[model samples]
Target: VSFGSELSNRAPTFDMDLSDFMDGDKPISYEKAKEYFSQDPSQKWAAYVAGTVLVLMTELGVQFTDSMSILVSSSVPEGKGVSSSASVEVATMSAIAAVYGLNIAPRDLAILCQKVENHIVGAPCGVMDQMTSACGEANKLLAMVCQPAEVKELVSIPTHIRFWGLDSGIRHSVGGTDYGSVRVGTYMGRKLIKCAASDLISQSFPSTPTQSCDASEEYEKYGVDLLKSEASLQYLCNLPPHRSALPY
Candidate 1:
């Protein structure tokens, strides 16, 4: 497999031997790719996207029977919170989909590419970058609700405001230990808060007086208020400022 930038005039940046990864029509997998390409970060990413494509094909019940080469190229800088990896995955996914004549919807492609990063790449990242790289129009800023890549619209860049990315010399890798640790910690907090809220909400808010105090215990709920017209504990965004325990 060869990875190159379509925008660049130079040769492909990375050439990898994928014979071992895709041996004779055998389906690729997350574990195989992870262990095989662990030593090379670049190759790892390449393998992940290819593996993801295979996984998707299997899920769709496509009887694919041949090993194929993939090309993923991008000019975006890596490890700086840019969509570098995502751009490559989008390009590769698009190419492979085209080759297979699979008419994958753009939004579905974006979401699946996100899985390539989050699950296959072992990077706990949102799908904003994939959505941007997949759905962005020329000279237009993609506006999306990135819970899992919901594209609302695309807005043109205003002449008055220019988006710039200057190198700070500090590098970032989404799959790195620091990034993973932070994500895990944040999600841990969410879990703790959700558990606490489940106990806080009383489903029987306005119940008739119980015949006995023992029956009152049953009426005094200690869990999610599912009976409410709207549940409020699932998402942090639904919580109001005054009522929320955590600061924004």
Candidate 2:
């Protein structure tokens, strides 16, 4: 599959030649592409383009000799908490895969797009945006679990109900926002909680125990392991106000 682009009065200009990007008669390296994209602000989409090429090259174990062109026109507003980047990344990946005759599954393709966004685009993002864009069905909502990265359920929207997006007129970029710091803060919070629970356990259970200690007391005791368990975190998040000890 080959892509060709010609500039006209009514068309957009997009023409990229893979052969022209050779280094000493060999294909340009990913490192060189990364460096070139990193140095230019006008080539913001260069990372995504390089990411698509690199992923396809790695998967196929062959250099792309043909030139490809992409002309994108979208009405969707950029930023504003919307997934403009993910859409672009997914589209780019799909186009490249289709042109290269690579049979990439939707989920796998989404994962690749997420990796490109995170590593190449310098945006710390989860797979939600890419996955949804790739796998979403019409008139349905996708429920997903991020930890293991699986779709739990798909619920159909009621016919009577309509959904529409209203631009808030505020532009926000994930890289420019405090989103990365928020994620770091959450991890740090979990670590602090685990440490505190461990300290509490050490203070409560010493090597020398009282004579009153028995099976019943052991059954009632909650160890640090239990406190640090996954279930414990869920419980803490959902605990009732009266029973909750941790501040929000």
Candidate 3:
């Protein structure tokens, strides 16, 4: 819930103290944090915080000249496939940004959280969980797209309907589940589409003639065009179940 930083003589260090989970606080040096990430069996979820910090420092060029301490107090159940990890990533980034007096926009913050989950945590997740956690409005359902992540709309919830959540007591981790396989299957399907619809892709993109296009480049260009074209999107969505199953 709290993150504090102070100047340090050695490399930047990080310590996380979980109030109710772990026995007590554990301090991780910068080198140790890096080592933890590289080890065969990575540091598990604990590496997420360190990874986020490293990404902020390396990718966003946030210069932190101090060691930091993170304290988390939470009752949320983990491994429930309910985005507890995404929430933690967002909170950690927000707290770190606050301590450094950095102002991060909500959408951008969500993207950063996704980066932490995807690149740092090896979760291959989209931005929905992070975006919803970061920008959710009371009594509203947020609509967003992952490719070009943006809040499209916030539909007001109907007053007549009540939303309720039930805990099934079954725990799951995205990295440890079929989530990655599904994502891979989706991309594989897209690649198959690119192959089958090569002529269409070429015709749609006249300027970039398919004759001279590398297969990989063609796939990338087709993906970009597919996401940008409403007609193409609709066609894909309206595909017959049989045709749709072909890619998988």
Note the residue pairs that clash in candidate 1: none
Whose TM-score is higher: candidate 2's or candidate 3's? Answer: 2
Q: Sorted on lDDT, highest at the top, how do the candidates line up?
A: 3, 2, 1
Per-prediction TM-score to the true structure, in the order listed: 0.70, 0.70, 0.66
Residue 160 shift from truth in candidate 3, angstroms: 4.0
Candidate 2 runs further than 4 Å off: 1-33, 59-62, 201-226, 230-248
Tens-digit lDDT string for candidate 2 (1-248) = 11121221122232446653567655566546556556656455557655777656644465777666665655445666778778878888888788878888888888888767765666767788889878778889999976556888789999999988787777677655476666555654664554455444445576522222112233226754674362235312211233234332
Q: Write the per-residue lDDT of candidate 3 for residues 64-149, one digit (tens) a residue.
A: 65667776544555667777788888878889999899899989988887766665566767788899888888899999886677
Give the Cα error of residue 27 in candidate 2, in Å.
8.5
Per-residue lDDT over 1-248 for candidate 1, one digit per residue giving the tens place of the 0 to 100 score: 44443333333444444455455576466556556656665446554456556456545546555766655545677678787778877878788788888898888888778767765676766677788888899889888887645889888888788777899988887778897667656654654544434333433443422121112233135333431312233533212233234432
Clashing pairs in 2: none
Ranking according to TM-score, highest score first: 2, 1, 3
The ten-residue window of minimal lDDT in model 1 covers 208-217
